[model samples]
Target: MDKSWIDWADWCSKPYRAKLEDFLNFAYVNRDPSSRIYCPCRKCENRKFFEKVIVRQHLHGNGFWKKYKIWDKHGESRDGADSLHRDEMFMGSDDYMEEDMVKVLNGWTDKSFKDLLDICNESMPEGVNLPNSYYQAQKLTEDLGFTYNTVDACPNSCMLFRNEDINLDQCLICKASRWKEDGCSLVSDLGPGKRKAAKQARYFPLKPRLQRLFMSSKIATLMRWHAEKRTDDGVFRHPADSLAWKDFDKKHPSFSGDIRNVRLGLASDGFNPFRTMNIVHSTWPVILVPYNLPPMMLMKQPFIYLSVLIDGPKGPGDKIDVYLQPLIEELKELWDEGIETFDASSNQMFQMHAALLWTINDFPAYANLSGWNTKGEYACPSCNSETASIWLPNGKKFSYGSSRRFLPYDHKYRKDPRSFNGLREYRRSPTTLSGVDLLTQLQSNGILTEYRREDLQTRQMMGLEKPEKDPLKKRKHNWKKKSIFFELPYWKDNLIRHNLDVMHIEKNVCDNVLETILGVAGKSKDNISSRRDLELMGIREQYHVKRRESGSEYFDPADFEMNNDGKDKFLIALSETRMPDGSASHIARRVRLKDRSISGLKSHDNHILLQQLIPLSIRSSLPKKVVEGLIDLGKFFKVLCSKLNCAADLEEARSRIVVTLCDLEKIFPPSFFDVMEHLPIHLVQEALIAGAVQFRWMYPIERCGE
Candidate 1:
């Protein structure tokens, strides 16, 4: 080989070998003890004290026995092996790096080709990396840098790992230790207490819908702190500052309280009664359905989400990240049918506050004339007269002069006999008026055109109107209560989680609930058998305990609904009422004959009667006590009904009649009439209506009057 080619082969054939040999040569040339000053450790000194041949023999494991143990007091891991309480900080698997790797290699030059640049760079570019990106990369490198955030003060709230677009609450207790450095959270000094607590209650795979609920809860609190309210004077007139919502949200501050949390409990045990009823009714945008939650979840709808915000010092962590997707998808389904969600924020709960103050319950304003007031009209207080629209409501109509921008309109109240000063005494009049139109048009026999006929008819009808009635005349109907409805559309995806359904609580369900119960009953008992939330709701009992400290009633589904497949089968009502409504008259005992056939009755006209048989059993793969409890529902409802208020005849309540079967392998008392206490899902009709009517109450009159 030529000289140039020979040198090239030597240079290319060895890479790792070259690097190692080069370092070895450098070490040999400077063989003094001081030359091993790269490290002051004993390990480095031992290697330096020995010559190259001895070191090479020891490293190659060629019968050069010097196998002394090296103790890692700090438990530092250099290679990829992970120790129990230590971390692997370096990639130390480079010991097998091959030497002479270039000769047979086709890509040696290409692999290190970065050593060749399109153009030479004499110096580094200034500020090549951005501060934000650099810091962001650094933030994710260490566990010491990690922090857990709380969604709310409640322990039941789920937790998240970091800040994101959504808010998924992470268990504050488990994450307390990660936030000590921020001076924002009490991350240290808590003997792993929070970690164990978090382990006891944690949600995996954060969901989006739940995340939004966490943030929404925070917003609800701020809204209650600031809202404009006025007393209801029978006259329906309010002061200027009292009414301002019409245009305020447009320029709201950064801390605007947009999320309104008109909260009720959100758990199966301490569930909200209002939302439970809505789920039973299959109301659009109201029944929280998931993206693809099975029909089973649709039956036992979950309750309202609780929105809470911590008021004091942050107890343990950074801002809790919570997921909000699961809930959002459910809301979208209602729009398919054109439904809406209600802004049941704290602002709507004014009646209670008003009652305490002994002020009017509500008040509103009614302006008659509004327009860009010209020379004969008044100018806008904010902008000059040129820009505003001019229109008139009934009361102030008389003072309003003609303007090019004004449009006249009237409501039923405008014709009512209520006078506010002279505001009530106005008439629709523009002085240049002469109503009598006399038309003379000769009809052409061949074709009396459409325009000519229309003109003749208009002229003939100019003076026609049912004569005006006196606005001062009082109308009795005004005092009578009239039914009004408003449309509210909200979507939810919490169908299966509602404790009432899973636990077999029927007090809040109506006819619709009964129907759903029966439908589920029609299926095999092997389905829907495993829901632990059911046991907490009293579908099964483990010795009833009265816990005064927590204000709770306890039951265990494990005692009954448990089946072989690991499902809790609570008792279910076999019979159902015919009317299919919340009314007490609709309650019917679902009859599952001893032969396992569910029964009900229908008259000769095909109208369902009070009795019949349907083959029904509470079967579930999960095998929980709640599923088994369905078998003895009559006894359960009787005991439950005995404790609840008498809404209607318990015998007719369809919701009470449908049930589950739990506790085949256990024994318990029938029903405790002495301590027969049951709770209602919703305490007020108005609140229940609001939850159920979300998008369905589309009638404007049903909504609260502004």
Candidate 2:
């Protein structure tokens, strides 16, 4: 166990080679010699995997990662290490002790904080003691350098009281007072020198947070994982393997030159911070996930940076762009003139630049970020002006069909009018608009006007007020305003600017399919209105409501809908089902036997149901064709949600999903195909370009906020 050779200057020396061979032999003793092992070379840093022979060669060429004396990754453990060495590593470090203390204090609640402290004090010997109070423990961890800056915001979200406006008592645009109005004061004044701001936002500066990623040698190495250790076998395990990432690299070689240059995905969603449905309030937190790290670390809470917390009693809809000012300014600086960051792993300083690859959000929030109206006839963002939608008079909502157009031209579904809407589909899939194309459209349509801080100041200086909306322009296009993200120099060139969240999409699809099949009253998509829509279309006559001689309506049962007996069997099967721990929640708890339906399922539960459970549960109850169609839909999601995918597989999935939707169209009423159902047609293509759905989805972001 003598580690003296690890520090040897001459790696080629016979002594060093002999020691390395000994270490390798010891590490790979019972394991296969040809199998991959963690290479401990200075260049590899135990991050890259290599065969034993290659690892030996790397060690000889680059020397060992000198600090990695204990080979924990290579089967060695701290328990087997010399006791004295273990004590020196842990007990001797004051910073380590303080970090451990902070972790313990963080888990303790206000009611249990004192109880935990008393227990710690009793356990420790004579003179040793833990912090006496929660505040004392908090102060102990103050040196950790975690903090947020509070900036007073206009109550109307008109502007932030920062820089030039820091001294202003009232908003220049609205003439509203900055401070909260006193309840007892008569003249909007409480005779106070300082008062609480009407609203405040927490801004966590991006530069320092990005720089801190490299301060630790362990995390510093991980930050380069996408470029360094990722397998280049054409499989999409990480975002780096995706076409969009490679395309970005090809277009911007300078940014890609350094592997350490950060690639970030922004996710912002409003949540009820109070965790109560009765209280209608929302707080939106903008989080940035650094994609430079490998899949496992990138989506984790600790690595996700909270750039801004937009305070809200009412969610900032389109006005969220105002709250994103600080973040955007920092991002602009990061992209233009990079910041100098010290990488602990390399022991050198280098300029680190970052670009926001895309944003992850649900459909409603997508409208707020992209400056597009995600409702009405032009709801589908990808489809844009070409969105295929029809208003169902009875359903009173937009039903997105015409899925046969997305099918192959030679496919029978294209010519089969009877199976789909009353007309045959010859139209091809809609063309996806490039960022440049969108920008040009916005400019031509007169919707690309500047709306940032400088524009506001310019308007104020000219003694001009905000202009009235152009009725013609509004009627002509869905463009609300050019997105604030378009201001970034590279935003236009990026392929996927904002991702469609797979989490919510999957849940919605599952709910639609499940409720309709189960015939859950009120929630089911196959209601009386849906039947009326079918009757108006003059298709599926068998399903239309018939007026009996007695005047009671007689509706024929659809193939997709389960009968009372079938419903009982389906519910019973789901209730009796057991899942692996942590895979999903208890199915029985969600199953309401009295109601004969499932309820209170969380997002993950729905994910599981969509991918695996529903397909299994429906096989015995539903008709063969209906069962096959639902199973195909389930398979599509299962493949889409995978952590690893290849281009060929995704391409096949793309074709398969189109047919699946067509088949679903034939089975369900037109009213069942909402925008959520249409979204799946594009998900496979996105997975091919953006890699696995897990990284782009809101599941991790939602869990982190909670």
lDDT of 1 by residue, 1-706 (tens): 0112212223324552354344345334423322221211224533333445544333333221123222121232223232323311111111111211331233444323323221112231221111122233223232222222332223322233333512323334333322233245443334444422221112221123332222233333432432333223321121111112212222233212332312111211112223444443210111221211111221122322222222222221111112222222222332222122222232132111000000010010000000111121222211122222222221211121111111133433233221111123134422211111100101111111111223223322542111123121132111111000001121011111111111122321222122333333433221122222222324333343435567754433323323323211212333333554542233244344333333332211011221121113344422345334433443433333231222233323323322121122122222110000111211111112111111111121112110
Per-candidate TM equals 0.18, 0.81
What are the per-residue Cα lDDT tens digits for candidate 2 across 1-706?
A: 8888999999998888889888987776656556576788999898777777788899889988989977766765433443322221222136435545565546657447666666776775432346666666555444344567899988877788999889888887667788887676423365555577888899988888898899778999999888778999999988999899999999999999999999999999999977789999989999999998877787998888889998879877776888888888899999999999888787788999999999999999998899887877888989898988989999999999888888778988888878778888888889989999998888877564234766555545654333344342346456665688988999999999989999999999998888999988998889889999988988888889899899987688888999988888898999999998887889789988788888888899899998888898888899999999999999999988888789998899999999899999999999899999999998987888888788999999999877
Q: Candidate 2, TM-score vs. the true structure?
A: 0.81
Candidates' C-alpha lDDT: 0.24, 0.83
Assess the local accuracy of residue 532 in candidate 1 as a C-alpha lDDT between 0 and 100: 22
**Relative to the unseen true structure, what is the C-alpha lDDT of residue 42 in candidate 1, on a scale of 0 to 100?**
28
Off by over 4 Å in 1: 1-265, 268-503, 507-690, 693-706
